[model samples]
Target chain A: MGRRILFITTDQQRFDALGCNGGTVARTPVIDSLARDGINYTRAHPQNVVCMPSRSTMVTGQHVATHGVWMNGVALPEDAPSIALTLRQAGYRTALVGKAHFEPLLDPFLRFAENRMGRDGTHSEMFTMPDGSVVPHRGFDHMEFAGHGAAGNLHYVGWLRSEHPEVMGKFVPNLDGDLEVTTEPGGDTMAPQVRTTNDVPRGWYHTEWVADRTIAWLDSMGQDDDWFCWMSFPDPHHPWDPPQSELHRVDWRDLDLPAGYIADHEEREKVLASKPAHWMGWYDGSFVSNYEAPLKWVPATLQPDQVREINAMVHVKNELIDEAVGRVLASLRARGWDDDVDIVFTTDHGEMQGDFGLLFKGPYHVDSLMRLPLIWRPAKSAGIAPATVTAPVGHVSLAATFASIAGLPRPDYTEAPALPVNDDDARERGFERVLTEWDSVLFGKEVGVRTIFRDNWTCSAMLPGTLHDGTEGELYDHANDPLQRVNRWDDPSVRSLRDDMLADMWDHLPSVVSPRRTCDAPV
Target chain B: MAYIRRDIHIARTPAEVWGFLGEPARLHEWFPISGCRVEGTKRWIDLPTGITFEEDIHLVDNHQRRFVYSIVNNMLIKDHFGILDVVDDGHGHSIVTYSTQCTPNVLALVTAGAAGQGLAKAKRILEGGN
Candidate 1:
């Protein structure tokens, strides 16, 4: 038997959401312990600050341009290189048991196989390929998918409909009749993505279901087999709805405003105006660049209490996710696979979460949307030191890292090197800069953005768009302005620095895909 | 006549983005249609919802990076003409525009929305790599 790999990911989580990451709100002891005894990444960023692109990068270790899933609606090609597939080929049992956003969630006619899995009422059982070959779905020998809510033809939805059918309506309807995300105001704050009194029991919540299903999959594997299980949790993302029984964990009235949030409307507007036009455009309802942002909910109308409420909901949801992680770890311990398992904990991307009075995320390149809380707890038998890695890293390096953990050769298609331990290790491995990009055409508006993070400074280069010419962009020095309240893109002192960063970013970017795929679903 | 225009700047050469626009058989690659069949200057597009549109290809100007077509047999459309143009943005990128003019402005809204999505997808395909 070899060291097992357990990859756990949360959706749309911020760097400051964990206790070890200086987050005072969410008491995430389970993950914080991983940081205490493992390698904690302080400057990890996603290649793309969205779900499908970031998740694709994680699985393939390829850039957005390389994988070609540039935006949400576009699906990652079925035959795209997958870390699970690579590990499976290396004789490891692989399974992904949670939110696999590799395919868009907006499939009405079940065009994509991911959405069609549970359409016939069989959930998570091995699916047969179109050619009648009983192959692994995207490299996972077994799979189960759970999204934010009961919206899609997912395994979790099927289970809920069969076993706990009455609680099905407890979830806010994720999509409307047009197959678009519903923007109905929910919860006491009247926030568009919030649902206050979701009466779903804690046991029936998708978070618990994901953990349970992961444990079941692990239990099914032989004790001597080397396994790679990606236990993804689809919570703390949107609809801000945790099980009502667990909402008592955090109180909105007791919570303070997030550090990135500017309470004063005028001051927030001032900060937003300093950045790119889309920041203010999305906040003031002048433009809608991405379908992720709720159409009916105006950021300008977001109240301070609503931010507090949303933060509280996210905190409660985080605690639930932490508990879920603890339960899964307990399962590993019970199976005696604890010390031989390497656990990597991270998220797809960060949420805006009332940063500068912004609720959701879009093309913004600030830390709120870019920085991720990444922790890698290698197997105790590996004899690696626990240290803080400050050098820049991107989610694109995960596949190679998994390959290294599995003692297999890195696939030729994987781009980045394996994960590094400390600043010196990272520097030695040439892990100096992390790149993030945003290119989306939404609501008849096109936005093109490329960002590079290096030397504690973040720089973004915006292409010509409806609001401004290509000259507009954002530059922030984390050493001084950690919250990124001000932009220095146009500053004379940082002109050379910004120009160099932009040059490096553009020069390093991979070529874009021709004849890009269409976004079938609003998600 | 109701007129609608939508343009997207793709990070590719004008000619590369124009390839999908100018070719009738490649219409399904970027547009909302599920399949496309061409018979000489006449083309038929099948939507994912099972509706088919019969159209006549007006022009395919390779030098100008422009494509023009019109619906000849459709009950709901009444009269429709569509034009797609890919122009060089001078920054090694191309600005692809899709415009449509048709009777009954309400129908143009649907065409405009679909064109907007198609243009966005076109930009992604033109700029994204496998």
Candidate 2:
């Protein structure tokens, strides 16, 4: 057995959210330090933007097709091999400490854990109550996690009432339906009893429990070991709110709302403008007009004040996670394994924290969710790559990279390893041409493709006008507009460029996999 | 000692599904466990008042979904399964189902409701074709 491996992933962590990448410093020293010593791939993107699918991509280097974890209620492809199997085969102890949303396909390798039920989520929290009632929040061996689909705002349950009386009536699951989230009474809630405000001194939040458990595991390891461990965070995902203390830090007066604050009268004619407004009661997220909506979590533009509060909340969250990262690293060093172990740090996806005047993350592939960060600390012998990979890449590389490090062989079923991870000059291998694609959404999700360039020439193709809802064809020349504020789809000069991108997207389809063969694009 | 057993070829392998089920955070992704929240060390207070409950995963039979854990918080139900039995049936697939009787919580009336929901989610998760 070689040195132990520590893999930690943050929930909804954006690529630009890190200090090394000019992500707001609010406070990410530990993560930044990890980047300083490791080879940071500036252009790593997720194979699947959502939790379940993205996690599948992380375990299997191949896209959704090969690994078979395409939808929420789907199982992993029977033939597909996961990273854990390979590691165990190689004689290393493999343990996943937190958030492993490889659902529908139930994480089969969980048997390796001496312990189970680390993180908490909606489905995991569902349980059979004492009185023999169907209670939400099932999976965790411990109790903590609530909600269904996107309805459980982590606050109050729709049907299940909390034992603590003081928090009663503080949360209403049925209150928010603007976006069709599944609300249930049987779930975990964060109301007056457990306010999500960034206020509590740092260690009291739920994230603290996660980190404490995972770090303790690392602390318990001995030098005679080679192990693979994963720690996943659930925050910065939803229920965005100003930490009571951090609230108003960025007042509406100080913030610049996205172009799509709320749909204009005319825009309302196209999509249901009030849909997002109604959902505000259930979630805490904000996005801009140009913000892309995801099929899973629908995005909504927020009130100017709501936007400021959400932004402050986002910052405070980063601070919290940053501290958690610092603590983990301190403990790693204390164990005398810091310099020896390989550390992988990154997130599931990015949160649209009011950037596009929208709150929370949607199913669409906006730069917010699709373009997440991938930071890796190379082994002592392997050199680190410094510049950002301007090329396009997919999230599938997580498994490929880890497998390569452990010298594990690739499984026979995955879509294909999209990119190769390198200790040195790896950024050069980032992406020749990256393509972004979406699976079947609720009835109708824009099933299109996006191609990004090192030079920032971006093209997206879906249903016509998807640029707003699920439209078709968006072209952006980022050199002139770094924020991608303008879409030049109609630009005459880019006629040939548009054709080229379309061809690239169509060609890349074969490489990405989709679980729902029914919704899969015809070859 | 009665158990209902069947085998199906889930799109992903046992290892993959195990990865999904291994973490408590992933329950909401499938099986409709509904809402959840973790408190204290291992005590999980489910909502809608089924009575407080606590459970712990004591060991794993790696070859099988056969995990041994005790349901204690509620005390009313002594539902426990030691072997998950996640093995290939040799018919181009594998079988993973537990055969444990629910001890029933305070609401003995709804015990079956909870059990049915859990098993249904497991079936959908294990057999869903992504």
**Leading candidate by TM-score:** 1
Report per-candidate TM-score of chain A alone: 0.97, 0.71
TM-score of each: 0.82, 0.62
The weakest ten consecutive residues by lDDT in model 1 chain A span A121-130
TM-score of 2: 0.62
Task: Give all candidates' CA lDDT scores.
Answer: 0.85, 0.49
> Per-prediction TM-score of chain B?
0.94, 0.56
Backbone clashes counted, model 1: 9
lDDT, residue B40, model 1: 89
Clashes (backbone N, CA, C under 3 Å), per candidate, total: 9, 98
The candidate maximizing lDDT is 1
Give candidate 1's root-mean-square deviation (CA, Å): 7.5
lDDT of 2 by residue, A24-106 (tens): 53567888887777656666667666666677677776666555555443444333456655665566666565455454211
Tens-digit lDDT track of model 1 for B1-130: 5677877888888777777677878888877778889998999988664678899999988999888999887766678999988898989778888888876433454566577777777777777842
Q: Which residue segments of model 2 deviate by more than 4 Å?
A: A73-79, A104-201, A241-301, A381-388, A409-430, A443-455, A463-471, A511-523, B1-130
Give one digit per residue, the lDDT tens place, for model 1 in A46-79: 9999899999999999999899998887788777
